[model samples]
Target: MSKRPINQLSLFTPGLDTDPAVKATMREAARSCALSREQLCDRMNELAGQAGIRLNGGNAKQLTLATLEKWLNPLDREHIPSARAIGVFCRAVGSVEPLQTLVAPHGLYLIDEQQVRKLRMAEIEEEMEALKREKQRLKAGS
Candidate 1:
């Protein structure tokens, strides 16, 4: 019932603050990227191959081409080729922005990326502590 793939969300999204112009810009960038979902997946697969990294199916969810490149070929910087290819693809498609750069500052910074995961884990710990306290209170009441 949707126009796009079932698993895919539209690449174009409104800006964080919900400005129409920003959303327009994002849509423009996604269009410029010039890659379909399948192509992006293959690009990632190719990079993984070059790094000689064997990715298990389960781990694939956690693995991204940029992340894998940063981890596996940190010193060599060979993975840059992949980024450049994507940039060129974007340019050819009339995309004015380096969509990667646009999105990275917002989505994939060292602090923000790590903080959200840490916060979720902290929440889990807090729930466990509350449960433990509740159990003690019940046992004392009896």
Candidate 2:
């Protein structure tokens, strides 16, 4: 019986390489998405609204296609999306590549729930092997 959702693995992509070009990553993520730029912006704004997200100076404004274009533009470094916007964008695009790229340079990596369970299972196996070794040592001493 698991307390967490069984489908959490869908949220993460393990073993993905890092890319330092955040703007390029974002651009690629958006470009590869099934939604058009206008549709993507619409989806981003919809998600932001549902989550009560506000950008820039905290005013309630919907994300515009022009703003998204600026963020996607490599030369327009000044208009990088906010963390909230990034979250919304990732959700809207159905890909975490942009977020993963941002975190990779910081020595952080994303792992799925299945990977975490596998690691824990391996650790427990190691502990069991250590106990077996101790049992053998005890029998020899007896």
The RMSD of every model to the true structure, in order and in angstroms, is: 15.4, 9.6
Q: Pick the candidate with the highest TM-score.
A: 2
Per-residue alpha-carbon lDDT of candidate 2 for residues 64-107, written as tens digits (9 for 90 to 100): 78888988887775677877787888899998888877776444
lDDT of 1 by residue, 1-142 (tens): 8476443434564244322332344345544566654455465456556656544334553245454333223244332333434443344344535444435435432244588899899999999999999999999999
Residue 10 in model 1: shift from native, Å? 24
For model 2 the local lDDT of residue 83 reads: 73
Q: Any idea how many clashes model 1 has?
A: 0
Among all windows of ten consecutive residues in candidate 2, which has the lowest summed lDDT? 11-20
TM-score computed on alpha carbons, candidate 2: 0.77
How much is 57 displaced in model 1, in angstroms?
Answer: 34
Candidate 2: lDDT over CA atoms?
A: 0.78
Error of 2 at 44 (Å): 0.5
